[model samples]
Target: MMARDPIRLWLNAHLGLVYVFLYVPILVLIALSFNKSGLPTAWTGFSTEWYGKLVANPKILSAAGNSLIVAVASTIISTVIGTLLAMGLEEGRSNPWLDALVAAPMIIPDIVLAIALLSFYTLLNMSLGLHSIVLSHAVFNIAFVCMVVRTRLKNFDRSIVEASIDLGASELTTFRRVTLPVIAPGVVAAALLSFTLSIDEFIIAYFTAGAGQGSTTFPMQIYAMIRFGVTPEINAIATIVIGFSFFLVLLSQRLNREAAP
Candidate 1:
C-alpha cells in the first residue's frame, strides 16, 4: 500500500478532536443522568430514576406545559406570517436593505433582541404573560421561517400559480389549492424549526414572561434550577429537551432537503 499523506492524517486527527470536543461533554452528561447514585464523580449503576422523578415534579410539568403552549402558538403564528412574507419577498425584486431588515432578528444578539422586546412591551404597556411571550417568540421566529420558506420558493415555478389563476381559480383558491400543496413540506419544516426554537429559548422568555410561576417556561425552570447546582434531575430534563430539539431540527433539515428542486 502507498504511504498515507501526512497532511491528510493531520486533517483527520484535527476533525476527530473537533468532534470529541463538541460531543464528549454531552455524552458524559447523558451517562451521568442515568447514574443510580446521581453523582457525577461515581456511577453506581444505570437507572431511569432521574427521568421518573421529573414526571412526578409538578413545577417541571407546569413549566413544560407553558413551553408547549408558547411553542405551539408561536409556531402557528410565525409559520403563517413568515410563509406569506417569504412569498412576497421571493416573488419581488431583491433589495439589500429589505433583505437586511428581514434578517435583523436572526443576525442580532439574542440578548439585544430580548432587551428590545422587553422595552417595546414596556413602551406599549402590554401585560407580561404567556401571551406576550408567544408574541415575542413569534416575532423572533418569523424571520427564520421566512428564510427557510424562501429557500423552498427559490426553486418554485410561478407559472403554475399563474396557470391556476387563469384556469378560473380565484387567487385565494389558487393559493389554498395549488401553491400551498407544493410548498407544504417547507412550511412544515419551518414550523418544526420555529417550534424547536421557541421551546429552547430562554433570554427572551425570561425578559418577557410575567413575574410568576404561571408564565415560567421549561428553559426558565432549567435556569432557575441550575443556579444552585447541576443535579441529575436537571440532567434528565436537559437530556429530554436536547433529544426533542434534535429530533425537530433533524426533521426540519430532512424536509428542507427533500423540498429542494
Candidate 2:
C-alpha cells in the first residue's frame, strides 16, 4: 500500500476522535441498559429485567401512547403542508425574506416558541392536551420538513415540470404525477425527521401538553424519571429512543442518497 500522506492521516485521526466523542457516551448508555445492578458506575452482569419492567409500567405505556399520537399527527400534517409549501416556493418567485420567514421556526429558540404557542393557545381559550401538543410540534416540524424538502427541490429538474404542463396536465395532476414522484423520497425523509423531533421534544411538549396525566409524553416521562435519578429502566427507555431516532436519521440519509440525481 502507498504510504498515507501526513494530512490524510491527521484528518483520519481527527475524524476518529470526533466519532469517539460523539458516540462513546451513547455506547456506554446502551451497555448500561443491560446492567443488572441498575447503577451507572458499576456493571453487575447483563439482564433484560428492565425491559420487562418497562412493559409493566402503566405510566410509561400511557406516556408512550401520547407521544405516538403527537408524533404521528404532527408528522402527517407537517409533511403535507411543508412539502406543498416547498414546491410552491420553489416554483414561484425566489424571495429571501419569504424564505427566512418560512425558516424562522427552525432558527427560533424552542423555549421561546413554546412560550409563544402556550400564550397563543391561552388567548384563543383552547384546551391544552394531546391535540395542543400535536399543534405545537407541527409548528417546528413544518419548518424542518420544509427545509429538507427545499434542499431536495434545489436539485430537481424544472424541465420535467414544464414537460408535464406542456402535456396538458392540470396543476394538480402535474403535482401528483410529476412533482411528487420526483420528491417522494425527500418528503418521506422530512416526515421521518418530523416524527423523530416530535417524539424527542420535551420543553415545547411540556408547555403545551397542559395539566393532565392524559397529556404526558414520553420525553416528559423521561424528564420526570431523570429528576428522581437514573436507573437501569431509564437507560432501557433512553436506549430505545436513541436507537429509534438514529434509525430514522440513517434511513432519511439513505433515501436522500437514492433520490440524488
Candidate 3:
C-alpha cells in the first residue's frame, strides 16, 4: 500500500479550511433567509415569510424586472461583440499590449470603471436610465466573454474554417456554417457568465442608473434596503442571487466540459 504524502494532506486540509471560511457565511445567510424573525441576530424559527414578502413587494418586482432587462440586453451585446473580438484576435498575430487592452475591464476596479462610465455618459450628454446601465454592463462584461471565448478558441480546429473558405464559401457563410457551430458552446457559456455578472453588478449599475426608481436594479434595490438596515428579506434576495449565479457557473462548466475533446 502506498503511504499518503504529508505535504499533500496538509495542502488539502488548508484548502478545506479556506473553502469553509468563504462559504460558511453564505450558508449562514441562506439559513437566515428562512428564519421566521426579521433580524439575523435572532432566529425565532424557520419560515419563508421573508421570501413571501419579497414576492408581494412591488418595488422589488420592478427592480428585478429592470435587472433582468439589463442583464439580457448586456449579455447579448457583450457576447456578440466579445465573440467577434476573440475570433479576430485569435486569427491575427498576437500583441501583448492588445491583449492587455482587451483584459482591462476585467482587471480594473469596478468603482473605477463605474466612474469612467459615468463620465463618458456625461460627456455624451446621455440620460441615465436602464439603457445606460445596460451599455455600462456590456462594457464591463465584454472582457470576460472575450476571455472565455478565446480559451475555447485555443482548442479550435482552424483548418475546418480554411477548408470551408476554399470550397467557395463566403466569410459570412463559413462563419455561420463552420466557425459558429464549433464555438457555439463557448459563446453560450460566455453569455451565461455575462448574464450572471450583470445580474450581481451593483457599482456600475448604481452609478449609471441615474436618479430614478424606474432604472433601479436588483443589487441597487438590495443596497437601498440595507441602508434602512439588514433584514431577512435582504438575506432572501442574496440567497436567491447566489443560487442563480452558482447555477449559471455550473451550467457554463458543463457546456465547456461537453465541448472538450
In candidate 3, how many Å is residue 80 off?
0.6
User: Each model's TM-score?
Assistant: 0.96, 0.94, 0.96
The clash tally of candidate 3 reads 0
Q: Which has the greatest lDDT?
A: 1
> How much lDDT does each candidate structure score?
0.94, 0.92, 0.93
For candidate 3, the per-residue lDDT at 94 reads: 91
lDDT for 184 in candidate 2 is 93
What TM value does model 1 have? Answer: 0.96
Tens digit of per-residue lDDT, candidate 3, span 137-161: 9999999999999989999998998
lDDT for position 70 in model 1: 100
Residue range 1-261, candidate 2, lDDT tens digits: 346687788899999999999999999999999998968659989899999999999999999999999999999999999998998898898999999999999999999999999999999999999999998999889999998999899999989889999999998899899988989998998998899999899999999998978999999999989998989899999999999999988998898788777
lDDT of residue 60 for candidate 3: 96
lDDT of 3 at 22: 100
Off by over 4 Å in 2: 1-4
